[model samples]
Target: MEPYKYCDNRSHHEDSPSTKVEPTDCPKPVIIGLYGLPGSGKTARLAELKAELSNDEFAFYDGSAVIAAVTPGGLKALQNLTEEVKNNYRERAIAKIKQECYNTGKTAIVAGHFMFWPEDDENGWSVCTPGDLDTYTHILYLDVPAELIAKYRLNDNKRSRPNVSAPHLAKWQAFEKNELRHLCRHHDILFTLLSPPLASVSKVGFLIRDFRTHSEAYNKNAAERKMLEILAAGSGNVETVIVLDADKTLAQEDSGVLFWEHIRALSGAAEDSGPLKALFSSPLGYSYIAFRQATLLYEEVAENAEFEAYCQAVALKIRMHRDIVNLLHLVRGTRHVRAVVVTCGIRSVWEKVLEKEGLSSTVKVIGGGRLDDGLVVTPSVKAELANYLRIARNLYVFAFGDSPLDLEMLKAADQAVVVTGEEKTRSKSMEKKLAEEIGKNGFHPRQTVLPAFATPRMDTTRLPLVRLTDQNFLASVFARYKNLYVLHATDRPAAKLLMTPMRDASISGSALRKVHARAGFYLATELCTQIIGVEAYPVPHVQGHQADGYRLLHEEATLIVPLMRGGEPMAFGVNDAFPLAMFHHAKVPCDLQHEHLEDTATIILVDSVVNTGKSILQFVQHIRSLNATICIVVVAGVIHSQTISTSRIARALGRFDGLSFVALRLSDNQFTGRGTTDTGNRLFNSVHMA
Candidate 1:
């Protein structure tokens, strides 16, 4: 693995400069330098690399060739000169390469050597001049094993060279790699060591290509293809995809803010002191993509070493949103979930951040650095990636984001989340916009708000905030609220006590009916008082005075309908809660005539259990057909949340504006039984009623 595979990068929220970067007038072409030992085969490698990365924009040249052509006697004359004379020629060679690349608008890759030393020497003096460090945007050293280079050197038929021992070869190789790497950093140049074979040379080629490319145009089909392969090959066998937006969505502060602040502190300048303002405040006005475009430009002029330090500094200070960090970790532990961080922020920054959190291997980050830094992760583009994962990759995608920029992506996901936080900390306009969007789409996303002072170091001993934004919450909200509530679930001791005996095969007769009545009464009263709500009314007190009291609005007109034998005990429980409310037992939907529902403001449908929801749906549908405007509440001991969520019965009931589902327990188990397990059969000690 590369030495920089992991770095301790940290930045603080308190450290920041109150300014913006000024812009530059014109940009320069990026130059990359390929360096290796004399016998390390740099020339052959460069040739192979050029062929592999066949782009018109890329131009390659030999360091000596530039000097030979510019000088009088070419490479032979320079070599014959004294050491001092060679130094001057080397400096001039670099200048010519830089000018040629600048003039032709090409990214140049110049093959060069850092220093020259004899076979007997323990250390080699570096020939890398200040001009070379200043001119090259990036420097990559081909670190072929000394043994491999030694073997190849022995068979070399090209140039005459001195023979060196294995230990001496190792020492010389170490000196060059270590010195060159430090020099590149000292000059703020991007440096990478390519340990050939363990890593492909083509990896560096792709990095260069991506640096110049934009993320907005990433190939969707290709990305899915890669994802599918990863899924099939993954240890956990990923089935669900969780897409998260970075910046304020996953972390406390925007990464862009932290990055600029670090830059200003490192450069010893006020944030607004330069042309950076002009660059960012241009036509796009510091939008995510615009900021990225500026980053690439800023990186071009920035000292490679200093910029990287700032990158690491900001990453070190990063404190991920506590809940989100935990959620991501949870997703990692679950073999079925594949988490993706899709951000419009700097890609390298997030890569470092996730790496620091120890989730880099499992979690993939899809982001960009510069505007044209390859694959713009726009809101629409984010959605495209998510939808593609679901439609083509066969992964169920759940997306979480903040701000209007994430709206499209949220809508494209199979499940979505709008992460919000304290008003003073989060985007107010975005929070409001997200709410409006959810209502407009009619598929409300689970909304999560982090508690005050939330940090990256979340407490795992307690319930995770992410748990509040899942299918269970969504279902419950939808069930209880016409606009929000879905299914209400409780694990109350009272409800559970009743449930134990109801599900027991040993329980039968009045004993089962008594448990059913008790559970129904508790659920009905809780729903009316807390969820469905009861109306306030004036009552006659014992002192012969009127006082404030609560009642179901129009209790005299309210009607309770039980679905025959199984629903009768629960219906009687409803009657006890609303003693004035009329009770009607019916086996078929037609038993409760239109006249029975007339003048009633609320209708309570009571049942012992609702498995598939077909029978209760039939009961409610008949009542709706008679009185379309009456409020309806369904109370049951047990009901499967999943059944009501996906069944057509739920949809048919959804047409009514006033509908509420209240149950003692919303369970996944749907038991079909007779004799002891069956509610009606167990209640009356009757034969199987199937």
Candidate 2:
């Protein structure tokens, strides 16, 4: 079997030594008491030593068993006893072990918790205080910091074990400060486990090796056999793995540079020099601000000048890097690999890149976007990738990144490959150096160089202006509807006087109904009714608490004219629930904005029922902008939530929010139950229409 494939039982026996007797002239049985704070990995070190020595011709018994035997009970009794009682128990246990070692001529490994001693000194080593020097041949102190031991204890999920708590942790800390000094001086071979000096795993391995070699029946190959056992046991059942980048490996630009550029762009300035120079002058310039500014600038200049074209060209240039394309392709092509592109870059740019390369079909791309604007990716790209890997068991993830920012992704991956671009680029070189540093510190994955590729310039200038206009239109729509509310108003004299009617009186209920029905009607009718005549206004409000930071709420308004009863309740409920709502008292006359009479504004016309829809049909006729962005007519009650074939209203609403209805109650007109003839009751009377 492969080294890693061996079961625990097999590995244990394979490493166990057959020889029984202690060698002549060998070192005396070293009853080394390995003492550290609970879960300073003391037990793990002991286990490693046992496995290593089992391969050597030695008989070793961990003093834990001796302590258990000497006590009234066993391990549980010693662990359950109070500190003072535990000390007495430990002393008695040590006495018994000393006698046994003297008689058996076999080495023993003792693990204990010792108090500090200030006066005792036998050798230059006085850092660790020893309780019973007569019993121990050498005291190997694994002196990890209290804080580190606490972390290991917490992560190990063994807090339920006896004496592993805050009080016990404090006791261990105090003992290390006062007792370790005396123990170090008396022991022949004292090994100190220093914190932050050696990697925890490496330190554990080292301690195990030291113990094996110092045993009476020392063997050179003991360490190797023990290491194999540990490795096999540790990695026996791993399934899925993910590898990710820490920096510009995924993003076209570094986060710092992106931020700097964003700030500069937000300040309304063109790059007189390079983005780097602008960023140097204004440190606050960042990619977010830059992208926002660029978007605004594109909107402004796209109409007449070459500026928009230039911006698009630059974006295309940055996004069309050959190395990125090849890497993405390789990941996509790999079996059992659901490739995901995660970056701190602007979503707009990456979306275009994915579309241009025809790779959008193969990979899911996540990038940065405005939070309030609703364009930002949700649940976070890193979190999404982690979720995907978790669901797809047996995955071997390979993450590639170039900077520290990609640490989360890299850590989440099963394996990581740091991609350092050309060394000629100082930025790339810096990334490589940082990756090297991280790798040295055992945080980074394997590194690889992504060779440069031939640049491909895609032209968007020749594409139809209609497409660009549509994009702008969609952007505007999303920005406007990031927050949606069904504003309600009644022309009841008091309410109308309190709030002026937003539109002219000529815009009637019928016109509003047409707008609502646009989603269900033909495309031409939708274009003519909702989008052309509906008016939008921005409402601002304040949000958040007093002590913390507050938010500036910018909400867009759409006039929702609901039919009485059912429609009115839903509209009012939605509007009343959300702040920053502006309900138009009545529909108003307005000139159509677009030549194509599409309903660009989102419209939801609500009603209680459509037994005949004679009222609804007439109402839809007055709508001018039929191509509205969203024309949804909602109701609190529907005869059929899924029966679109018979209900035109359901069919219409389905085109926008899909074929689904949010209703408080839904029932067919017919009654078949025992009390079917109670039609005179007011409550049940409305069931026919409903």
Candidate 3:
């Protein structure tokens, strides 16, 4: 028979040194303490856990037995010792258990106590040692009802126990629980308070399994995979995904607060303190374990169907802010932009709210309510999702959040909106954090007040204002991501004809330069015409009749910025295509002045070759800083195949508006030309100098 798989009459002999298995590699060993008052059924739950878990995967120990084994004179001698001596013995015992767990590669479930309260004592003596705090990864406290604990103590026939009043027991349990929670949070341990006696064992079983398999890396991967699937299923050509936080972000009211109020009213609680309020108010804050505890609270309150009804009731009362509703409606019609609600609040509530607003089919929600939902959107998860969407899936992420919880996601986003509401209804706690993020951290976010009259967060200069409901603003945002064009030899055979003269080794100096110049002219006349568009003007026909002639849009106002020496030829080539366009020489991004962009309708940045696109990115960003609305075109003789997808300029193409790229051809060659082979050296006939 396998060891530790079955509970026996012996007091914790299965985990002894003689039965220790060979160490195997695993994630950090999880040592969980089953803690409670003496009569709170910790022993019973430990036994059940031992029976349920695999012997190969778990080890079980009784705190007293472990202490006895490590003590000099065993259990009787330890009992006779002073409190300080017993604490030393307790620490040694836990250290031994931890060492055994390390050697065996098994999770350890230990039945332990927080304090031993005498009925007449002013305070209970806490028995938890520093070793226990450092070694234990999780602590599951059995918060059984005080009446049940008193009854269990009275009925136990195995040993004599103290007779404590129910009210006294309740007070004692409350103090222990509060102190333990604080210690767990400080020690970086996951803690959950399982209540009502009957549910403790079952909850622990699930939690133990989760502890063994789940990790921060695992959760992040799962969320990324789920989001990828959602993105794939929803839109075929999605360029931007707007990740919106539910609760106070989308609506003026917080669903978590509202749901707790409804639950409180139903339970006839004197205060608005539901289990959730108490759970969050604890030292756990918004940690992953705290969110899990919140889920368990919801699960404990009602059956699955009843829970759905409660969420629906909360959803029915929610009215999504008009600005957000209008923006989402616009996004729904925009084929390239997809919206998803990523929330830490109840998923069902947000889903129901979207359904009521007829947006359920358009916007998806990623969150958790019950344990079975399998995914919980914590703050870290939200941040990871935003980053994954931007990096992994290569989608532009526009995030909207209203609290400190959303800070990470906002920071990860390409564009962030801090949704502010009317003064009284706004998030008061978020202000200080936001201020710190702006003042200390290099976080720059735009604030969007739902009602235009509402007080803005910080000064308008610090967190600039954006009108999400404005049609022109939305159009400009959509314009940023919708245009990315790559012309390759396979797509356009005529492009190969123009590339032949430029690639020939027989060409050098002015001959090679003119070939590139012609290629640039051909690309401008063919590709630039289609992208930058054309405007018709009156012209004299050859037959002495008035006719219409076409020129590049706002041709006279266009500024062609040729990157120093190598790009001058192509700049002149582009100039030949549009004689009315002006030319500017730029060696670096700063070479182009703000005054040059004032009347510029289009700034075409011409380059001979874009190997890494670093130079192109710098120029485009500089141009955007000067003029946000200028139509920018990047023309290159040949762009490396990888540079079209993974380069800095490729990423920036989706982040800036009115930006387009036109290249003569794409080459898979990763070579960066040097000396004679260099485009710049050959363009200037300076290869011999190398």
Candidate 4:
């Protein structure tokens, strides 16, 4: 309901060079202004920027209060008094804001409609009189068309208030237009129009904030300094800084089983038939037996070979030192890296490990904790650690982590890493079902493994350029690449295909496509590309006895389709790809016929992106009713690293011989700060024009 609920004022400051006063030796706070009409998604942008800044050292203030104060009769007085007292309230509010900035060392962002005040003329002003414009340090005008604003207003649930009038909306629009143009011409303000969407507005604000605050800190390090130089030289579009946790991430952790085993041995239960096993196997049995005395007796042999083996496993399984070092080198060597470091961990351990491997100087460390207890860690704590590091010096925070505990940190970080642990925590059947659903939804799964220490690599490889004129190229690409097709899978096809293409064009397009095309093309030639619009019918296959060269009849080819925006146009490409294949159209109440096929028929599904393979997985389960041989092929334009690293796709893929993947591109580009073009938009326009 409150789609733009998070949008608000972040801060307020004077823009006059004379009024601009450097507070302290403390890093100058970055002041970014997010300007837009009321329904232009300014708040959502602010929220995202706030989330990113939460992990950095810089402070953020949504200048909503300033707007509220400046409103007619001031926000508080308007609530209690009539319109007559409004002007008096406005003057007081402005004074208070100026005083607050002077007294507290905090920057302010004021959000509200501002109007140009001609020096020579002061005339009839209805809503509120023109005030001094020198208060803001940076002015950003969110140039959104009035038509779009009207659409947003009509659709908005919260703004549908009885008190809001057409007159008020018109006045606000007129004031904003005049003020934005004035700021652009008169002040040294940075004005950016909202071209992409209001969703990306907050990112622009964050960029301004960083430029104002930490640009210098970023220049201190050699690599970062070089990056800054490159950026200054206009060699890059947007430079990204990635920060990651270095424990169970760059290094692997020995299975916690080993640690548990060690604890069991320490408690004197070293025997294979120890009470610990009983405790795990049957908690009730161990509790009822009162076997404490027997367990203690076993403690005498706790430090034996078994216990040592467990410790060795725990230690060795922890990510290899070489791997950690290699990862550090990889991140640092990448020209885009502004800064890289392990934010928090056992400082001594990290230092020792890095030093021994000669990687100590490669990155900075902000770790402090006793090694014995492992680090007392959480996402917020990591966020705080990043905050401290950022505050100590101006810096942007990009982070990577593996557990749910790292979620908060990920939310706070400008960029994030969701590292996958090497374990199948979810049920294998569930994983299989999910993968099938994802395939049916028209997305392919692409996996990325961190290169080995010895691998010679640093800079990312470029993708092969394809000047595709067909708008349906994405759907066509999906149809050709995706490997899995299940009858009645539960996800939309087009959304899946969009993922990889949107993320990393190179990895998914090249590495993934090569492997998938090789395996999937061998499976079948008569691929069935279905454009599920409103319905579909099942084709029956004839049962026959085995014979020499018994060509499989009605071998179900893969079904690949894309989930289109506004309309299901992606289905047409799928239909075009497989002319002879059966077609189905999907709508709210899906209606389709089903006929049982050979148990071994391969089905490859395709989609654009795989944010979460839940839909695709669910769909796979639906098609299982046909009892066809089910192998999945998933083709996605872009694939989030989390899906590949943490999701069930990787584990489930091993379950079937027929399963294969062909992604046009795949990488953790979502939060990796990697640059990627919006292929969906490009492809859509191409197809629309064609």
Top candidate by TM-score: 3
**What is the number of backbone collisions in each predicted candidate, taken in the order shown?**
44, 69, 0, 86
Per-residue lDDT of candidate 1, residues 326-369 (tens digit): 66676665676677888867667887888898888877777655
lDDT of each residue in 70-162, candidate 2, tens digit only: 677787876786644555555556666655565565666767655322122221112122235545554455656656666786778754544
lDDT for each residue of candidate 3 in 459-567, tens digit (9 for 90 to 100): 8666767788655457545654433566544257777777877787667889888887887788789888888889999999999999999999999999998998778
Residue 570 shift from truth in candidate 3, angstroms: 10
After superposing candidate 4, which stretches have Cα over 4 Å from the reference?
Answer: 1-242, 250-321, 337-339, 346-352, 368-378, 381-399, 411-559, 564-577, 580-690
Model 2 root mean square deviation, Cα atoms: 27.2
TM of each candidate vs. truth? 0.40, 0.24, 0.73, 0.25
Task: Judge candidate 1 against the unseen true structure and give its global Cα lDDT, from 0 to 1.
Answer: 0.66
After superposition, the stretches of candidate 1 with alpha carbons farther than 4 Å from their true spots are 1-233, 273-281, 285-292, 301-307, 370-374, 452-690
Candidate numbers, best TM-score first, in rank order: 3, 1, 4, 2
User: Local error of candidate 1 at 177, Å?
Assistant: 36
Among all windows of 10 consecutive residues in model 1, the one with the lowest summed lDDT is 1-10
For TM-score, candidate 1 versus 4, the one ahead is 1
Candidate 1, residue 620: how far the Cα is off, in Å: 18
Cα displacement (angstroms), candidate 3, residue 415, comes to: 4.3
